[model samples]
Target: MRFVPLSSRLLPGYGTLVLAITLVGIGVSITRPYLSLFGTDVVHMSAAELGLFMCVNGIGGILASTWLGRLSDLRVAKKYIMLVAAACSALGYGSFLVIHSYLPLLIVSTVLLGLGASAFPQLFAYARETASRVPDVDATFATSSLRSFFSLAWVIGPLLGSYLLQAYHFSGLFAATAFLFVAVLAIVFWRIERRPPAGILGSQPVKSFAVLQNRHVVTACVSYVAVYTASSMNGLYMPLFVTKALHGSDRMVGSVVALSAGLEIPIILGLGALSARLGKRPLLLFGSLCGALYYVGAWFAQRPWEMLALQLFCATFIAISVSIGMSYMQDFLPDAPGSATALYSNTNNLGQMLGSLLGGAIAQWAGYREVYLVCAVLAATSWLFLLRGKRFKAQEQKALRAALTSQDIETTQTRRAANGD
Candidate 1:
């Protein structure tokens, strides 16, 4: 297929989804960087408590996404799913303004925001399915561009977020996040058109809640978990590490993250274009290597600019891992975009959960800098899993070829017998 420029191939009504996704991106990026600060500064939670808070949040997201993800394939329209998620996000963040207690806040944040998280994967699945219907559109590039647009939102989101945090305080930050989510809900509800479930449209993909069990799929997911865990740890702690340990200001936190996310847009789009030619695994391995280097560099950085400069590698790592990771998982089960993207996205959830729990514990026990060291180790560990996945994929291909050859030979013998040869 000749891949065309995204400008010409917005997949008709897909511009609505893109707008919805970008809203979601801005909404999320606005508050995510400040979660740690909110915990320590506003709620006065200990590190361990923050870890538990994040873990619960992660679990909720996993459960909600898994259920909705499978349901989207079966009967529910993705538009509806996104609507509910966006609403939940708005409610969840809004709730933060009133509830300051630890336990109540944790429960509320976990369920509402966690369920809201499903909108993202569903959005991607919608894009993938939409792209599949249009012969001219390259589904891979389509999805990648969606991610880039989301990143583009981040370039503005964090800077705006920093201002909100400084001027309006955490309450204001959460309020703005909630408002953005409301915008997501409004756009999805009004502008986005609904399609019948993918199954109804005609696809007999693997059914039920069980994820794809192929060796390659499993290994790749495992690798994703490790790499993303490291990335999540960096996200969870980088704000505190800079402010507390390095004596950098709050604005520095936003600047560093926004800079990396800004750099990520172009890199993600380019790699998405090249992914078909270069293949997903090579780009993933390269990304994993970059993740390790960035963390190690971060671990040693004594100044703010050092951390800021490392974002080049950080941008590359995020671009390849996030953009390619979705397509890689989908290829393992091409017929089920919802399930595949869910599976891919859930690996991220698992990683975030572990990273949240682990980062907090490590920071409390050892120190902030040590978390980066741990992240570096996890990044390197991801490469081993990637290598294993490659071998398993090769073996699966070889076995498939052997099965086909044997089937052909048996058919030939049967034909000869029928002819009395």
Candidate 2:
């Protein structure tokens, strides 16, 4: 037998895949902080309108991800799909430079780049295919590690955006993000090698809406949505919580948010190893519980230092919960990893959109403190879903084993009967 080298045993185009995802992450992060700022300052849109824009964008992503994920599984050209997505994002974001009206920007933000955000689903599908081709690779871990790279981008993108906004205003940030997307498209086109079609990744054709029928998957998706919502709403309101409630400054909010991001690094690095040893369910449940506790603590925080400490605690739990949830989703839908991932991704986006809207509304009606309490309730409620998830997983494993055992017994009986025993 001819021996294959270790490098050859690795996934094809893995390097390019990582680079593409990292650039996408950076591109999004580069403009994230300025989205709200742009709506308020440049477009002169109200908070409700901004929230609706986010919701529509999220809904667009939800539609695109499921359809595109199915397309990728059907062996469509992944590089071409990525190129289209990146190109659309670039054009949409670039157009913002010339269009000053709220309606045009809203349409661009919600329909155009929002649809392009579907690229992540296809990107994940591509990663799954590449990882599947390689020997001795854990696709779950590879995917998790790929996602952690986004956090690294998160660390730098927002800080850069904030600085650029200080210097050149909202147009500068939008233009910069457009340039980043163009760079992403260029790098992916240059690096990825196209492959011939393999059969559809799944055993049968899957309808886009059919995925929602899986109860455990639905529970997991909803739990994830809740977790992400808490994170997004907190990010939006934390500045106010620190400044008005705790008597702090922009510098103080920056320090706390930075600390939160810093704390996630170690958690992300260690999560896979921990999951291997401790198993996915325990980690998921523990992380969810911890998230609930963190929000509860945040509600009680009275000083800037206390808020900072609470946020650090929250980041660790969020990292663990998200990593575990993602791994769990892949495990449950092993045959359709892309679709599973897309569902989780959509749930996360939906959560963030709803959280921002709801949190803003609560803050406006009652106060920041009430908003914190609501997030606490939401996080805690997520744990209930996890409890049911544990039972569902157990039943599934048992049924699978029982079916296998029955098949084995039937095969043995048939052999003996054929031998005239």
Candidate 3:
């Protein structure tokens, strides 16, 4: 099946998004993967303190992103908001070099890092709005392309991070992250055009609480939380499940990690192409089932090779949920791009946190295999939640039709005013 590639015509409006997201994605991948190691080895923190550090960072990210998400849809241009987010994230990452103490580090993660992380979702929000103007391109496809750039960055980010970490230590690594974010700022200032607030749909920004009142939004958020939580749990324990239970070596763990990431890049693009034809709900349900299928494979995996091959299902689940899921969430609240992305981001952050905590407990209390079983259950449950909400499409179509009618009226009014009507 042939697909429409990223056309050159779309680049002027969109090219910077690719570059900016790549830089930040690489920067994030470089430092975040090794953060726990830095905390333990550098700060000399106790186990509980380390846990506190991670928990606080996660919570801070949620609150900061959610609040900033709301503010972005208001009077100010989102590009300016994104500039601030990039600066804060840079400061937060750079601070890692100097602040070796736990309390001060906690403060930075809670504020700066939290605020900084909001930029990624804002980038998606910006993409959604911009893509809406470029009618020739499918918005979902544009978002998926951006998501692919981030995914591609992650594939290489770890190797580069390892080199930097080995050579210059955490100082060099964090310094690099800060520098990259600075590049993101330059890209935003120069490339991203200044636009008015999010009125592309001719709808005023609604209150955050009002958006959540929609049944589809709530249902989608909860369902995704389950999928993300399951994915998180699987990621946390997969290594142990291979090593401790299957008696596989670290090679298998590395193989699975690398393979899953490798497979995700293409699948993200492919499913994105299919989305315009197959519709999101079907693909979403299919992805959710993939998660369950992968976990079941992991549960029965006796050899490392068998586990390595199961990455197909794992990659499918991740691509659909991770990349396409954002667009799906936005469908529920087309007018509030910032809020829609923020709500999706919060579910992701919340799910990962829950997975880490719950996965650890399950592994300790039961076994590595049981963790997979529980996650399998969660994945299936998430699918059911989305499936039951089949009526969401009717409302979604009605909203889109209304939005189009409103836009046409506004255009005619603007033309009449220009003619001195």
Candidate 4:
């Protein structure tokens, strides 16, 4: 058997995507460590208000992802859409300079930042779009590598965020985030603004709701909702849980996040490369199952170190669910890659929203430790959904092949008619 090397499959502009994703990851993380504190201290938001704030943020992200995701599928170039998203994000983060009170922060954070953050799906769309232009390059593998760059960013961002927050405070943090976005925007604009959009086959605007009718898309979206809900629970309350439940310090919280990302980075890259051979569905299912196990492990963790140790499992789960999951989603919608990516992102945002809203309410009544168990259940549910939908995969593939064959036949007939043959 002839062995195919991974590097041989890489498409053009892979390096550029790596840089862009890294910057985005860092920019987003620079503010993450201080976001809740900034809301509470700078704006004096109550707990309920803060939760509502997060929900609004998540909703804004979902709306942006949905609208812009569909927009990417239109005649417009994905890079330009990316530029607009970056500009909006810059504007959104820039609001921090003028924001002093609650209402203003709420408005800017939800509408502006939310819209700005929509660039994430656009970035994925752009990279995938670029790869699609080149023959023989596996777009999934290329995008997976790009996605791992995000994990790399998280590893660097949070630690840097912690230091900047302590030294220069909110001003430094916001300024850094703004700078990162501006830099990325400038790079993307310079590189792609004048370039023509990737000529994707059958690339046309798709009715957003039409995708939901497909069982594979619907089931995948629901599975992601559960997966992301579990993630949101970890993102929102794990730090509090560490402090209150495990008697760990704030620094420990940062370390916990770092450990997961550190472990996840290699896993994401490795699995992404292997995905070509291993296949997306198996990776997704295995990851979902591991995710459930990780949450269960987290629920049982008694010490901060135990939480750190549990991250090994968390990394495996993330490796599949994050980048690999999105790639798997694209397999079901080869003709509408942008819409497919948008659906994946929308599910993620929805998950974050539901997780934050419910995680808080649950924690108040059931205690923080119990929340992990709930997350474990959600993860398991996601796995079941994925497993049940496995049977439909073959059907979806057959339909896609038939559609492509019909298109090819029609094109050949047109050429023959033009030739008067």
Candidate 5:
């Protein structure tokens, strides 16, 4: 069969999923950057207290990714799960209007909205699995293309948040975010929930974590965790490096962030296509190496502008890892795209937890620059796991073939015995 382009294979309803993601991204970006500020400035909580509160959000993400992500794969409607997630997000964000204390902020941000944010990954899983039904579609590329919508959201969300902050303060920002999620829930519930695409029905219930049994999946999970952890560490400390280490202004930090976010959109969309051509492994390896090199270069930056320039490389690594990483995970666990992408996302949250703690400790003990060195080491370690996964692929394929052959033989013997009797 002739190869069908990923663009042509996308059905109409997939657009709804992408739009939902963009909305969610906007809602999240509006509040995410401000959450710490809100807690510290408005709620009268200390920075330390805010940090602990953020940790609860991370824990929520971890729990949701592991549990709810799999639930969508096990005899449940993914759209309904998505609906529940959105409602929770709305509830969490809206609560900010009434709840000003630290405890309420913690409960809303960490417990409710945090888990609700897991809908992001679930949406990806739904897209990947749904796209797989189309013959000749590059499901990974399609899904990654959808992923870029969030990057687009990142570009606009912060600016929108800033406007809300300047105009209406935290109350406006939270209300706008809550309303945005509610709007998405309404749109998706009407478009997809009322009329889901065909072939989205759940399969027989398998072991909820059965995908973990695959060695390739496990190794890929390790590599994903490492890559995300490094990225997370960079995210946490890069601003400090700009301000304290290199004496850059806040404007410079914002510019660097903007450049990276803007550049990542095209890079991610372009590389999603590239992965369809060169395959996911090479892309994954290349991305990981770039990440390692980018961090190592950060170790020697003498000026803020130099670090800003380095974001070019950082953008590349991020684009490849996020786009191809999902593709790679789905490749190993073809039968359960929801579970596969969920696990992939879980590693990211796990990485965030580890990276934040590790980076904070390193910064406290050594310095902000030392944190980059640690990130480089971790990125390199992840690359090693990627290599292991590559080498093991052949063995895994051979085992799969053997298992199929044995099952075939057993079926034949049973048929023959029945005929003879």
Candidate 6:
């Protein structure tokens, strides 16, 4: 049960890589809440438009993530890709200052922010490659821990966004995000190392469409999409549900959101350790089941406190599902960890987009209760998928072991024949 620390003897470039990731987290957090707020307050858009804009963002992420992941594997310059992405994001955020219309905002923001999504996959690939070069480090665990820092940013980012909105409005928030991206660009240019030679850093071109052929990879991606949808459905609509259905005040809703975000940290840290010990499949199934149960719990709650309590449970379940599912995906595709991580990450973005749009529509037509009920169903469905995924992963592992064993026996026979033993 000993936890492995990332090796201290990392290449100088790794430090810049971490810094780049931190800045990206900060940049995104700065603008996260403002996107919806801008659509509502500034552009006077409806809930549906807000949902669509968010979906647009996800579409951008999906396109960028897949391409950037492949590019990272091809030993492209991480710093160069990240710097351009950060600059594009900064431009996108800056454009919001003058963009009062929906269409322009959508196109500009997606192009800018969507490209920004490229940063994380590139950084993840860099981290995995760097860790592999170090003799003592476990790259998978290091990547997991490194990714956890984004959740930590989520805890702080929303609070900062809330305060910034209160003080300076949407423009201020976007401007702040722009500044963060500029800082990211500066740091990457100044500090990041040049791309290492291919194979030296475990960087190699991914065979075309090979990741899609892997059953475990596909299962993990699908499971993640479902789990993310379930989680984001609650996040996107729970505040409105609390305010409208339960007669909760804005203060109360904010408290619920804050509590959920704050609670995720411990849940993530604990679940990370638990996933390693108990294995990923059990945690994935259990987490999804608990998530479904939490939504059902929310449906029956009449009081504000009851809803708040359910939010905490929902957050806990999501933390378990995401942390474990991501680790599971990485373990399955250890050879191309970047693709695995990118696929998992993109599923999250897609899930959020779909969940937000669907949740908003359900809340609009069927009522908030129906939204929770639908979420519960989605979560429960994920359990079935995870069960199937578990079986597939076990079979894949067994087959791999058998292959390795045969290879070893063949090597032994060849050695014996050569020595006439």
Candidate number achieving the greatest lDDT relative to the actual structure: 1
Across 280-369, the per-residue lDDT of candidate 6 in tens digits comes to 778778888888889899989898999777766776676776566666655554545556667777888889888878866776678878
**Candidate 1: worst 10 consecutive residues by lDDT?**
204-213
Q: After superposition, how far is residue 126 of candidate 5 from its true place, in Å?
A: 1.8
List model 5 lDDT by residue over 31-70, tens digit each.
6655645765678764345445655667788888777766
> Candidate 1: lDDT over CA atoms?
0.85
Q: What tens digits encode model 1's per-residue C-alpha lDDT throughout 65-92?
A: 8888888887888899989999999999
All candidates' TM-scores? 0.91, 0.84, 0.84, 0.89, 0.84, 0.83
What C-alpha lDDT, on a 0 to 100 scale, does residue 341 get in candidate 6? 65
Where is model 4 more than 4 Å wrong at Cα?
Answer: 193-205, 391-395, 398-421
Which residue pairs show collisions in model 1? none
**How high is the lDDT of residue 283 in model 5?**
83
- Tens-digit lDDT string for candidate 4 (124-205): 8777766766787767767777888898888888888878878888888888888899988987887653444323435333
Clashing pairs in 4: none
Model 5 per-residue lDDT at 236: 61
lDDT score for residue 321 of model 2: 68
Give the Cα-based TM-score of candidate 4 against the true structure. 0.89
Lowest summed lDDT window (length 10), candidate 3? 3-12
**C-alpha root-mean-square deviation, each candidate:** 6.5, 7.4, 5.9, 5.0, 5.5, 6.8
Candidate 3 CA-lDDT value: 0.79
Instruction: Determine which window of 10 residues in candidate 4 has minimal summed lDDT.
Output: 197-206
Candidate 3 at residue 379, lDDT? 93
